[model samples]
Target: MADGTTDQGPVTMLATPISLDFEFTPGVAQSKFLRGLERGEFLGQRCGTCGQVYVPSRGTCPTDGVATTEDVVLGNSGTVTTYCVVNVPFAGQAIEIPYICAQILLDGANLSFMGLLQEIPTDQIRMGMRVEAVWVDEAELIPSLASVKYFRPNGEPDADYDTYKEYL
Candidate 1:
């Protein structure tokens, strides 16, 4: 038997840093979504079986667990189903604190996605508010949602809660 002691023998410890370099394909649905973003478009996928549409398309029907095949183009304007006022700061966040992160239900789509809300007073922001995508210049368009700088009030009336209650 060995007693619990650190004086038994000399021990050596080594530490090292490692970096990762990898590449992958975004798959069929994601690739189509990214391609649409590059052209300043919103492409959603439709579940063949359930007929549910997903924005930034998940490539599958979450409810039915079936692969989405049909591609649907969505409108830039949408309704804010819900939102939060960000009062705390976190690492790697580019915008100033006290901003609104809203879940928007784009027109013609069945799902809602989160995006930064801008050009609107935080105190005035509310659920069911109408907003539209503010896109960057064509020259700056990339294969990413970054092309859509942010969503802002579209000068439309706020929708009733009942209109978007399912998303919330």
Candidate 2:
């Protein structure tokens, strides 16, 4: 008891698990986006003023502060604008360490959204890397982003810096 050192080298504490439930209302624009996901469609809303598109839109444009009513169907493919390798492990994480989490700029959309990148080595991940969504089985899909499992390389040429510089 007098000595500061102990036989145990380190101590690891597991987090206490808990459950929470709540009901959420996906407003007009968001509802539309979710419905699109249910049907295997990648949908975004364009600002009536700036023409900027947003996925899973918040019902209004951040820049123009105007309602985004126009439904724009976007493709599953996109470019990686920026990313980080998840080297640290955490409690309840299902993915293995050293995964790539990148901000993908989907085709024809002005804004970028975060997505998991896989199928390519982490060492080879870089900005402007072309990628495509890996969707779940048709029957398993639902009105959620989870429909898209993850993204993988599409074997396409990298996008030029000029194309995604502003987003970075």
Candidate 3:
């Protein structure tokens, strides 16, 4: 009151509760890719102009902005372009502590995709390491990348950087 003003000691605010529900559908390009995963197939779409193949195709070429139409079936094997060892623990992680998360480029595809790297010691994993997909039991599979449980060492020599350097 000395400054001719009164101040409130504190203010209480109320928060409204919210409830929500959602359903989703993967569009045309991704739908086809997911369907292929259901049967352990690595399907990619090819851009007619640039001849670049894209796995989990978005139905368009990022390089040329052309519609990708040709269906290309890539092998399960690929090269690990890069990776990181995840030693930190987080809730809801299905794998054990200290696993690898990597970007793998399938043999015929131009882009790399992120996936779990398993079945080998983290110390043994490296760039250009060859790997192959390991699948879940057929009975347990759905149209998703989850069907490919993880990537494992393919017992092949590591690829030269020249083979996958562009992807890095």
**TM-score winner:** 2
Question: Which parts of model 2 are misplaced by more than 4 Å?
Answer: 1-19
> lDDT (CA) for every model shown?
0.91, 0.92, 0.91
lDDT of 3 by residue, 1-168 (tens): 455334654447776778688877888889999989998889999999999899989999998998898999999999999999999988668888799999999999999999899989899899999999999998877898889999999999999999999999
Q: Residue 136 error for model 2, in Å? A: 0.4
**Candidate 3, residue 12: CA error in Å?**
19
Show pairs that collide, candidate 3: none
Q: What TM-score, computed on C-alpha atoms, does each candidate reach? A: 0.84, 0.88, 0.86
- Per-residue lDDT tens digits for candidate 2, residues 58-132, read 889999888888999998899999999999999879999899999999998888999999999999999999999
Candidate 1's TM-score reads 0.84
Q: List ranges where model 3 is wrong by over 4 Å.
A: 1-20
Runs of candidate 1 exceeding 4 Å displacement: 1-21
Q: Model 1, 1-168: lDDT tens per residue? A: 467765666557655667799997888898899899999999999899888789888688889998898999999999999999999989668999889999999998989999999998899999999999999999999988898999999999998888899999
